[model samples]
Target: MASYKLYYFDGRGAAELARLVFKQAGVDFEDIRYTGEEWPQHKSEMPLGAMPVLEMDGRKICQSLAIARYLAKEFGLFGSNNMEAFLIDELFEIFAEIMNSHLVKIYYEKDEDKKAEIAETFKKDSAAKYLNLIEKRLKENTSGSGFYVGSEVTVGDLLLYNSMYGHRKWLGKFGVDVYEGRPLLEEHFKLVGALPNIKKWAEERPETAF
Candidate 1:
């Protein structure tokens, strides 16, 4: 087996979803965390000048979603079929949009007035636009109670786990009940969160706002 090393800051940011996938897959990898003071010295060495980078036996891959997707495929977590893989990948893409368009937008907006405006409507905007779409997808799934893609957990589920559960506090800051009015979403979150590996990892993982 090849060695894996994941480099990211010492927080449950982009890297956490990959970590959750690793936990679910029972794959062992080196988690290389960097502090704020330590990042600058190594930033120039990164493939895209950012993390979280996954190095497989020294060959590196950048971007957290890519890394997680690769690992999930290797670990039989992407899906059992090509169409399933597409569904899973598309779900993950939706989350990337939510993270970039709404979640991160609130924090990165330098103008306080704009930031306040974003916070005021963040929950409704995000729910109506993104969460509603996800809810519809959930309704399409078998029973609307199982994992997003198939009978088991997928990389997409990990991304969903991260977006809402991992960052629940941040969303809650704006009174975003991501699970509200979306019973399927709530059940899925609860089911995924209760998976043995995920539950154990969540119980023992470090506490972080995001």
Candidate 2:
């Protein structure tokens, strides 16, 4: 059993998926959270000047997706085979693209009108397009068991779950509801949230604005 320490801001923003993976795998790790004021003091110590960083036995790993991939492979969440791994990677990339393009703007934009415009576009366009595709993928899987790859829950499922959870929780403040008219996606969200480990982790997790 390797020792793990995760460094991230006091919010779920990008670190939540990795946390979910750890919980699902029954792994123990030190979750080090920082506030905005505390982050600058610790930022210089991070390898990439950003988080969420995963320290394994003192070796630092930067980037959220990279950490998620490492945990996935280490804990048997990658998939059952090579093709499944590839599919999971592809799905993860797609989710990242969506987050970068639409979701992130709402957080950084200062102008109220511009932020509103971006949020609406995200809800009407990006969320609709990508989430429906994800829903179709879930429905097409062998077991239709709500896992993203093969018949088991892969890192892809965790990624999608976190993305949807963020959109609902964070974007909901802007009156953006991505699940509107998407029954499959709504059901998928509920299913992921209902998983025993994830549900327990979520219940006990610290609250943050993001």
Candidate 3:
């Protein structure tokens, strides 16, 4: 077995997907969480001066999605065929765009008025449009397994669940509910939550304000 060590902040943020992947794969790896006060000292040590670096067998891998993709392939969650992998990659990209372009901006917007305005726009436009598209894709691709890709769970499903989980956790204060009117998504969320390994991970993982 290869030695693995993941370094990230105490909060979930970008590292949650990788953490989930590890847990779901039944892998034993070191999860090193840093405090805000302790980050500066370790920041320069990271390959890209960022958190969520995964050190595998002494080689460090930076970037959250890159690590997640590597773990997904390692854990057999990348999908069964070329077309399935392509679709899974597409969904992951779409989720990342939504997070970086809309959700993260709204979450960190400090000015009250500006935050409210951006939140409103996100709720009305970005959230609504993209969430509906995801719901439709899930409904079309789901073969009663509640997974976004094939009959088995894939990185696409993990990405969608983590993205929505972040939205609900951070944007709820602004009264943003992305699952509204999306029953398929809501059901999918429940299904993912109920997965044996995921349920244990959720129950055991530290609670954070992410």
- Expressed as tens digits, the lDDT of each residue in 69-136 for candidate 1 is 88898898988888889988888878777777776887888886676677667665555777777877
Q: Tell me how far the alpha carbon of residue 202 in candidate 3 is from the true structure, in angstroms, after superposition.
A: 0.7
Candidate 3 regions exceeding 4 Å error are: none
TM-scores of the models, in the order given: 0.91, 0.94, 0.95
Candidate 1 regions with alpha-carbon error over 4 angstroms: 111-116, 143-145
Across residues 1-210, which tens digit of lDDT does each residue of candidate 2 receive? 899999998899889899999998999999999888999899999998999999999999898998999999999999999988988888887888877877678779998778878888877766777777777777878776777778877788788778878877876777877777887777777878888999999899988887
Candidate topping TM-score? 3
Q: What is the lDDT, from 0 to 100, of the residue 167 in candidate 1?
A: 55
lDDT of 1: 0.81
Q: How close is candidate 2 to the true structure, as a TM-score?
A: 0.94
The Cα RMSD of model 2 versus the native structure comes to 1.4
Q: How much is 148 displaced in model 2, in angstroms?
A: 1.6
